[model samples]
Target chain A: MSILDYILGSRKKTANVAKDRLKLILAHEREEGGPDYLPALQEELLTVIAKYIPVDKNNIKVSMERKGDFEVLELNILFPDQH
Target chain B: MSILDYILGSRKKTANVAKDRLKLILAHEREEGGPDYLPALQEELLTVIAKYIPVDKNNIKVSMERKGDFEVLELNILFPDQH
Candidate 1:
């Protein structure tokens, strides 16, 4: 599916996984862009995720990976100290 | 102020911190409750924060601290590999 499609599509549903999840997908253009755009995009993506999913906020875990023109953000809502 | 106050009050305004922010505050009852409540509360809080803020979602960072009966969730929208 297209980037926009991914953003607008329904999230894969399943039973509680002992943790909440925040997933962010970013698409970049091949043309020239500011260096800061990637990180800014990353931050904005997190913000969007934060607003939707409910987590301790303090206990939330964020992980990221970047490809040619796509970035993925994985938010883990699991508490480390407890389990 | 009281626990309820913190939850309902306005968030302190500040400039873009080169990162987005997610904060969760949890209050517990004095009486007995399920042991799972704390982590559950944490997850819910992160979900709420993710929904409200815009971030790369993939690159988001989550931190948490607990004291007494209160838990604080601090979400950082900073990109680790980038910045």
Candidate 2:
């Protein structure tokens, strides 16, 4: 079953609910790739994710690094208290 | 700047930091799409997102639905308390 099927099929059982987590890393575009590509890709991913996940805008945690070829962007969302 | 740059570039300023949120949907694959494709795609996205976002696995909210030709899977992440 696909993720949708899994989620829907198991909705009646709280034990089957999947945890929510997301991570995205972006690298500087190669000379051939162009500098603008990475940023654009990241933006697209965020836009897509935002459209589906319901997050408290105020609680979002984002981190970034600019070390050498490894340009990384990390996002962490801490779910609220659960039963 | 790409998403990584945007997040990393804006790290120092809380206001500049992006909020954390994610959403994913899966549909029944068409004959051309293959029955397994939708599930696989959803799995791939979740795996990628999980690697980047830090969330309380227990609090993750997942919802699913199946209606005729449409099957939908939705994921929502709620961040913990923030300043």
Candidate 3:
């Protein structure tokens, strides 16, 4: 590839990264959580896992189905390769 | 302050920051948790709170005395000014 093509490709990548980050922020805000901070909690959790293993945030979901049992904190990050 | 004083003060601050961070890592590793990932869990949680306000990790502590009740997740960050 030409030098100009490489430069343009890198620029496109930066833009895409920014777009993806913004989209992620929006999605996190939009998601309804059992507690208001559940989304934040999950995001923070995924970061801790990232220190040990690479994970796809989109696929590795943390959901709480019922709150009766002292709150269910189900980290469905069992299948990292599913994504 | 003189330029040398300013520079020296800043250098000392940096050293303290590094020292504090290393001490934290060591403490986290040294502490025992029912689940091995408890330290990681707490650190990740504090980061979420930091998005909105400044926090002193040293002041805030997250600990679970007993885990018999569907796993207790206690976030002791209710007091931000304790530090």
Candidate 4:
């Protein structure tokens, strides 16, 4: 192991810890939102958008955030200068 | 303003701060990793994969973490039961 690895722990172990923590955080988020809705909406939107122009899934983001009285669903897609 | 908003600051203001902080963090990360490479690879991979099956852009995460000797690029895509 390198000096950095010794100081910071193995990358795989750290990644696993991060992955587990992410699962817990996502579970909490799922409870706040519905379990499947965000993922479902993201998928459906990608399918619909892909038919017309080229879809860059990595740049396509769907997010739902709560305001005072209600919630808002926001979609963001980044298209390259050429595309 | 709600009590929570007063305590936590306005959501829009808080979001702006968070966004700015995130930009700084991403800038640092980009300096460590190549600036344009990771995002470009992520976009290209998403484009190719979207051609075949339905894609969940939100769940499709591409990350590169440096190991001791090398770096590993990881792509994670979530597919549900229904098509």
Model 2 chain B: weakest 10-residue lDDT segment is B27-36
- Give the alpha carbon lDDT tens digit for every residue of A1-83 in model 3: 32222223333343332111100110111112222444455566567656744456665544443322122233534223312
Docking class of 1: incorrect
Give candidate 1's whole-model lDDT: 0.38
lDDT of 1 at B2: 23
lDDT order, best first, reads 2, 1, 4, 3
* Cα lDDT, all candidates: 0.38, 0.44, 0.33, 0.34
Leading candidate by lDDT:
2
| lDDT, candidate 1, B1-83, per-residue tens | 32222322333355223332322222221122324244554455445444534336675555545434333344445333322
- lDDT score, candidate 1, position A61: 53
Model 4 is docked with a DockQ of 0.05
Model 4 chain A lowest lDDT segment of ten: A19-28
DockQ of candidate model 1: 0.03
- Weakest 10 consecutive residues of candidate 1 chain B by summed lDDT: B23-32
In terms of DockQ, which candidate is stronger, 3 or 4?
4
- After superposing candidate 1 on the true structure, give the runs of residues whose Cα lies further than 4 Å from its correct spot: A1-18, A33-35, A57-59, A66-83, B1-83
The worst-scoring run of ten residues by lDDT in candidate 4 chain B lies at B19-28
Error of 2 at A8 (Å): 17
TM-score of 4: 0.27
Candidate 2 chain A: worst-modelled 10 consecutive residues by lDDT:
A27-36
| Model 2 agreement with the true structure over B6-71: per-residue lDDT tens digits | 433533354333444333333331222223333444555555555555556675676756554445
